[model samples]
Target: MTQALVDGTVIRGHGVASGHASDSPYPAGTIAMQQPYFAALGLDLTGLYLATINLDIQPAQWRLLQADYTFRALRWTDLHPPEDFSFIHCQLLWQAQRYAGYIYYPHPATKIQHFQSPRMLELVLPWIATISYGARARLIYRAEQIQIEPAALL
Candidate 1:
């Protein structure tokens, strides 16, 4: 479904994964649709979560972690999402995710924005949070020219 546009592009990776942690205190993928923005575009986002899968082996677990590192951060209130974390207490809703991803460059033709490292991941609390979370800006995979579709004109 078509919703709002942040800046110009919509975060497109939501609802793509279905593997959510079943036994976690905070509901898995609970913050899927909290797009609190002050933009003109209106959004009707559906609740998206990580797809479920089994971790029966070692290599499988590693692959899952890699995907989660890039895919999971697309669902947060900041520029970057955490990739790694060590939980101290489950009750405080305090968790961490590390950031690692690709960023596209600014070409003379397309003029897309360039992504920078050391991005930001917002916190639920105001202060005293030492964790850093942000999307590791990367070049668009394949580096193809983007064409604006007709549907976006409306």
Candidate 2:
């Protein structure tokens, strides 16, 4: 399998992931609460941050045809019904640093809130002190696992 690289820009996202959303109903953050459940299911997210960094790979949108891991009807929160999630291995390159992470995808068909745009590819990475909104980054992924195609003309 060939790994392809695409450049993207870091963008701000709904604060629900980091639990920093002032008006968010889930103050503790979605990931923080779901961590334990995912861990118990075998994905130990020990060193990874509890938040996801939204990356805009615009002019290109992603399709989740296949996932390295998928959890169906995960009962991680009581606020809403269980939602499905999928993740794929993602490699990031930023400022001469290479990061190993995952492309976090919450199945929209089952998701009830915090909807994300198709142009944005949410990533779960380790705590990176230098990363900030508006930074440029590149992601390496397998085409078969995560299909990226040109955005439809509007």
Highest lDDT against the true fold, candidate? 2
Clashes of each: 22, 0
Q: Cα RMSD (Å) per model?
A: 18.9, 1.5
TM-score, candidate 1, is 0.18
Candidate 1 lDDT over 1-154, as tens digits, reads 1211111111212221221445433343423323322011232222311221111111111101111111222223343343221101001122333222212111122211222111111111122133222322111211122212233232
How much is 16 displaced in model 2, in angstroms?
A: 0.2
Q: Which ten residues in a row have the lowest lDDT in candidate 2?
A: 145-154
Q: Per-residue lDDT for 71 in model 1?
A: 26
lDDT of 2 at 104: 89
Which candidate gets the maximum TM-score versus the true structure?
A: 2
- List per-prediction Cα lDDT, in the order shown: 0.21, 0.89
Off by over 4 Å in 1: 1-25, 28-50, 58-81, 84-154
List ranges where model 2 is wrong by over 4 Å.
none
lDDT of 2 at 118: 89
